[model samples]
Target: MVRRRLVGAVRSVFNDTARGERPVQPSDEALFAPDTPIRLVHADVTAMMVGGVAALLMQALHPRALQGVLDHSNFREDMLGRLRRTARFIAVTTYAHRDEAEAAIARVDAIHARVTGTMPDGSRYAAQEPGTLAWVHIAESWCFMEAHLRYVRPDMSPADQDRYFAQSGLVARKLGADPVPDTRSEALALIARYRPDLRGSPDARETARIVLAGTSRKPAERALHRLLGEAAVDLLPGFARKMLGLRRPLLTSLPTRAATGMLANTMRWAFGR
Candidate 1:
């Protein structure tokens, strides 16, 4: 049930973008800058917002879904291996720009702190409070989803705009909240009511794949791979085909092992495993 809604939300965001509606962030210019670096940054933001919320909701609602997805014997191991590969790829690509990644991480940490009312090294208070956790998760998801629909969608049609808003309202209703407004200022106002701490933070755009992978159950991981493929074709042109084709086999061979390793390492660090 939640999975289907999640998939629907993903499709709606993409479709909203394709229709040129202000579904996510309300500024198309920010999302489609002509410069390659800027474009990459924009893509990163879109992926982060869309994938982050999706991953969080999935984790909160279906904590065991990832295990189910990975139950295909060798499948899980192969995914884990692929992640390690992808991490290496990110390192190679952004090694020279470590500062940028770190800055982004800092921004995310700050936002997380503000929303959860605890610093990185602080106690996991939110984890213990179900109400706080659910509220934060839903708020984050709504913010990210709204940003994507506004800025990233390609077309500017009335139907698309209506659909985008409708979907946003549906999500809000699902969480027992009122719908967000169509304007950026109004949307921010809504976010502020729930996450007053994050009202003024500069928005950061971490890569979707990386952020989602950090969470326990990420519905968008596989979907993101597919999206990346589409993005490579439409935006990068031939990049995905050449690189992903070569990387796929290695990735496929060790999913479970890699995911388990990551999960184990995280647990060990966070809770002595």
Candidate 2:
């Protein structure tokens, strides 16, 4: 009974019961094959949450992407809601039937079509822009892999890692991301190419704060959220941390990593993974 309740609570956090999202059962016709790296990596709830936060920070560093969020999304007010929607998207795309995954992609594409706006510097920005979408995809895939490696599979093979990128690239292509990276080297090179376009605007920093601070009212939940946020920040590249004016987890790195690993293990156990 206790284990069942714990599982239900975790699922509720990720599944958004109010919106009719439940756990996605992996389908024989899912986008990726069963036991694939993408499936294994994305299965750990704790790692994905940490990685998702890190990815959001990385994505906000791009002025156009930040502008889109500021002008269109209620990220400031409904951060958890936004995160749940993203989690749902990943679950659907990764584990649902191919038709459902394609429909999910179509829904995102339609939303992107409407997410255009002008940046603060009088430049037009569209969420559907292929280059911008590529950055988003790269940041998310890289961070997710980083978190998975750190918390779940430190020795995941190079071939499997490459396969993960290749698998995720299919979704990126469907979403109109140009030049999606299908290997670790390609992802690094793509990030390098976009370095000049990244920035730490005021809006981005504020959003980062909101994301890391989290919205949990319960003290225990808040403490766990802080631990996850710190771990996520520690996973970022030094350049990204510097641009965002976020400090490295220097004195607390060991404890933070240890605590996060424990939490990851506990979550995995709770979910019977």
Candidate 3:
């Protein structure tokens, strides 16, 4: 019963029932073949939860992405809502059947179609922009796979890694991103190419700050949230961390990473999946 409660609580973070909404029941379980690597990788609760944080940290580095959030969303109050929607989208696209996936993708695209704004520098920003979409997609895929490798399955084969990236591109393209990278190295290189365009700003820094702070909860759950934040910070690229003034101590870096890994395991045990 304790394990079940722990699992329920973990699931509740992604589930909307706590907010008086129903859990997202699978529309169809035929999205991927039962044996697909993508299914296996994403099914790990620890990696998905940790990597989701890391991906958000990386995404906050992109100026327009951060600006879009500031200009468009009531992010502070509805933070969990935002996370639940993203998780729901990923779950549907990755595990639901083709029709459900397409519907989810189309719903997101329709929402994106309506989000438009001008940045502080008087540059136009649109949620539908291919570049922005690609950044979000790649950041998510990169962090997710990284967490999977680090905490869940260190020995994941290179071929499977490539397959995961290439396979993830399908969802990216469906979301209207052009030039989605279909290989591991290419995805990293694509992020590199965008370095000149990525910048640290007040908005970006604040986004990172709020995301890391997490929500109020009981002692054990609050501790889990704190550990996830530290793990996310650990997973961030060195320059990215510096950009947001999130520099960790050099002496404690090794121990911190080890602790974060252990916490991830504990989270998974609590998840009981």
Candidate 4:
């Protein structure tokens, strides 16, 4: 009963009951093959939680991306809902059947088609821009891999890591990301190339605060969320932390990692992973 409740609680956080989202079952016809690195990296709920936050921080540093979110998304009022939708999209694209995955991609593409606006500097931005989409994709995929390595599998093989990028790039390409990297070196190089375009605007800082502030109300859950948020910040690169106005205190890093590792183990146990 305890295990069931734990699993149900996690599902509740990731799935929107009003929209009738249940747990996504793995299918034989999923986009990637079984036992692939993408599946393993994306399967860890706890690590993904940490990585997702870090990814958002990195993505927000892109002015066009930040402007797009500020203009089109109700993220300020519905942070949890936005996160839930993103988690659902990742789950669907990673584990659901190819047809389902393609449909999800189509839905996002349709939304991107409509997400266009002007930035504060009189620069226009569109969600469908290849370079912008590429930044978003690389930020997210790299952060997810970093979290998995830190919290779940520190000794993840280089070849497998490259494969993970290659597999994930398939989805990115479908979503119109240009110059998608299929290996670790390429991913790092791509990020370096895009670094000049990233900025820590005031709006970006506020969005980062909202993301780290979390949306939980229960005291225990809130405390856990805080710990996860700290770990997520710690997982970010020093440059990114500086860009997002996040500091990684030398004092809490170790304790936060230990606590988050414990939570990851607990979650793996609950899900029979």
Error of 3 at 214 (Å): 1.5
lDDT of 4 by residue, 1-273 (tens): 999999999999998888888999999899988899999999999999999988999999999988899999998889889988899999999999999999999999999999999977797889999999999999999999999999999999999999999999999999999989999899999999999999988888888899999877899988977998899899998998998889999998999999999999999999998
Residue 54 lDDT in model 1? 39
Q: For residues 187-272, what per-residue lDDT tens digits would candidate 2 score against the true structure?
A: 98999999998998788789889999888899988998899899999999889999999998578988999999998988888888
**lDDT of each candidate versus the true structure:** 0.35, 0.91, 0.82, 0.93
Clash pairs detected, candidate 4: none
Between candidates 3 and 4, the one scoring higher on TM-score is 4
TM-score of 2: 0.98
How high is each candidate's TM-score?
A: 0.26, 0.98, 0.92, 0.98
Ranking by lDDT: 4, 2, 3, 1
- Tell me the tens digit of each residue's lDDT in model 3 across 205-240: 888889988766678767877777887888888888
**Model 2 regions lying over 4 Å from their true place:** none
Give the top-scoring candidate (TM-score).
4
Error of 4 at 17 (Å): 1.3
Per-residue error for 161 in candidate 2, Å, reads: 0.6
